[model samples]
Each structure stands twice: as structure tokens, then as C-alpha cells.
Target: MIKIISCILLVFASTYSFACKDPLYKDKYQITNFSGYSDVIVARIITSKHNDDEMYSPLMSFDAAVLEKIKGALTPNQVIHVSAKIEDPRAACPLYFKENSTYLLLLERQEGELQISRFSFPIESNNEHFSSYLSQVKSGINIH
Candidate 1:
């Protein structure tokens, strides 16, 4: 147990210096056409699975239940596949979603697969911006 805890601490400690903190939006990844994303949805992650592959590197694929739809083809209560690239070996990034946590995601659809936008990051429910996002959506304003 001690060894396992030590390893966990080591992994996080090593990554923390280089990793992007959760729910942070750096302006470098900002999108100009923020209002024109093809698929934007507010969803709650239901399940999470980790995959490490050559094409995707280490990525997290989540099953999320739609709580609200901001645009595009999704409907409330629908489940969608959400995937995020985790470039730990190079960038020290890890999976961003937590099970049962809600997120506002901007997406791009590619050949029937829904992918999180390169310009955006999932806004986790606990993020400082989460409430502002919901408020903007409620008032029909630009989200971020």
C-alpha cells in the first residue's frame, strides 16, 4: 500500500510541474469563431476509460450524458462519446474528466466521431468559469 501510494504521488509530482492544471483555459488555445462550433454540449461524464495508442498517444475516452445542448445535433439525455488527448510523455497532460462531473464541451465531428475541439478544453463543473458559462447560456450570450 505504501509503495502504491508513493508511486501515485511520484506520478502526480512529476507531472504537476509540466501539466496543465485541470479546468484551465489558456488563451493560446482560444478560438476566434467561438459561437460557431459544430457541436457544443453540456454533459455529465458517466464513465471513463484510458487508452494509450500510437495515433492518439495516451487519451481518455468518456461516456457522457447530455444535460443541455448549446448547438449542433445533440439532444438532452443523449449519451455521447467524448475523447481528450493526454500527451503525458511529451506534454505531461492527462485525462481531464472525472466520473459524474459535468462539463461544457466544444466539439468537432469527424467522420461520425465526435472529438473535443483542439481550440477548447472541457469546462469541468467545479471550474470557476462553469457558472459563468451556464449564465451566458441561460441568457443566450456567447459562452466564453
Candidate 2:
């Protein structure tokens, strides 16, 4: 009876999933962190390519037209390419992006290319506070 109960407890504990992150809100730390990004831009995803070869996690590649350049060397109307790996839905932060979706992304320059790492969170274009975050970062008055 003890072994059976322990097994059941282990199964339940191992199956517990943490809630995913909500990209709508940015605290003081988030604002500061976004400011440190190499490039911060608001762009509309013109195209998206999905790759599922890496097992459960799905990879997404995007080509977006730069609409606003809050910070960075990106020019207006330029096509910025970015890619993200949508992790398991049960993970704390699984980023989902769609073609034609607008997002405020923190892009880092790597090897002469812009890339989005697994830890980056792309804010939705519709987020009301998107502008606020940009302003804070741009003015360098964001929370420390």
C-alpha cells in the first residue's frame, strides 16, 4: 500500500505544470531589460515558416516589416527577420506568433544577424502599454 501511494504521488507531482507567462504587462525590471536589447522594434510579421523537425517544440521563422523603430539601427519599412521556438504549451513561457501579427520584439544581434532566443518574449502589438514601454526605454527612465 505504501509503495502504491508513493507511486501515485510521484506521478501527480511530476505532471504538475507551471503556468505560462503573460506578455501583456511589463514590470519595472522588464522595462529595463528591454532597454538593454540591441534592437527594439515594432513590426508586422509578413511571413512565417514553421519547422517541427525538433521533436515536440515547434520553431517559427518570421519576416516582418519595421513599422516603428524605438531603438536600433533598423530603418522604416525594412524587412526584419526573426525566429522563435514555441516551447511546450505547458512551459512557463511558450511564445506563439502568427503571420500578419504585429509584435514588439527585443532583438539581439548575433553573428551579423538578428535572432530571438528562447528566453525572449515578444509583446503583442495590441498591448496597450506597448507604447509606454517604448517611451520608458527610449527616454532611459525605465525602472532599474
Candidate 3:
């Protein structure tokens, strides 16, 4: 009887754990007005003429593909929101990039443009089990 009760309790705990999880990278980070998506290494952005500060207000580079999706719509010196995954808390210091940092990029298109928009960071999935999480988010978007 005790063994049977223990099994039932274990099943209940597992079900509850699964139910509480968030999908869609929603809990991870999100971006709005995200222009495009690109798969690139982190080193490129660090080496480029556009460092953290030059980008302005909130300074940081994002995935090339996401930037491309919205670049055409921005005007020179305009503020835009950028949403990105916060891999390192120290990367955007003084003004810490929000936790679970998915949002939007508000940027100013400048002359002699460094094309920082073209930069990207490779998505690292080895650390987290994100397959079901991403699928759930995708489904939520479709529903809307």
C-alpha cells in the first residue's frame, strides 16, 4: 500500500512540474518588432566598430536576422526597443539588460553605419531543454 501511494505521489509531482513550465521562450526572453533572425558567432560583434556604447541609450548588438527584419522601418536617430536573450548579465552593465530579456529594439539609423545590425549570436541550446518550451510559444502566437 505504501509503495502504491508513493508511485501515485511521484506521478502527481511530475505532472505538476510539466504543467508549470512556460513555452515560447517566453520565460527566457522575448523581442518585439524584431526584424529578422540570424545565426552568427558572438566574436564578430565584439570585434566590430560598433561596441556596446556606440549603439546608444541602451547599447548592444542583436542577432543579424532579427535586426534585418526591422531595419528598413527605422529612421536616423530614432529610438527603438530591442529584445534579446540575456546570456550574460555583465554584458549590458550600468543599465542591466532586463532579466528574461526579450522585448524590442529602438535604435537610430546613423550615417557611416557600422551595420551592427548585421551581427548575431549563436543560440546555445545545450544548457536548457527548450524544445517543448519553444513549441508552446509558437502555438500561442498562431492562436493570436
What are the TM-scores, per candidate, against the unseen true structure?
0.63, 0.72, 0.23
Output the lDDT of residue 95, model 1: 50
Overall lDDT per candidate, in order of appearance: 0.67, 0.67, 0.33
> In model 2, where do residues sit more than 4 Å from their true spots?
17-29, 34-36, 53-56, 85-92, 141-144
Question: What RMSD does model 1 have?
Answer: 7.9
Q: lDDT tens digits, residues 52-93, model 1?
A: 554333456779999988778899999888666323344434
Candidate 2 on 4-111: residue-level lDDT in tens?
A: 999999888766544344444645326455544777777898886666564333446678899878778998899978766334454544455777888777788766
Cα error of candidate 1 at position 2, Å: 38
Model 3 misplaced regions, further than 4 Å = 1-59, 66-123
Write the residue-wise lDDT of candidate 3 on 18-113 in tens digits. 442212333443432233432111111211112454323333433222322223444433333333332333332212232332323223334423
> How would you order the candidates by lDDT, starting with the best?
2, 1, 3
Candidate 3 accuracy as TM-score: 0.23
Higher-scoring candidate on lDDT, 2 or 3: 2
What's model 2's lDDT at 103?
Answer: 77
TM-score winner: 2
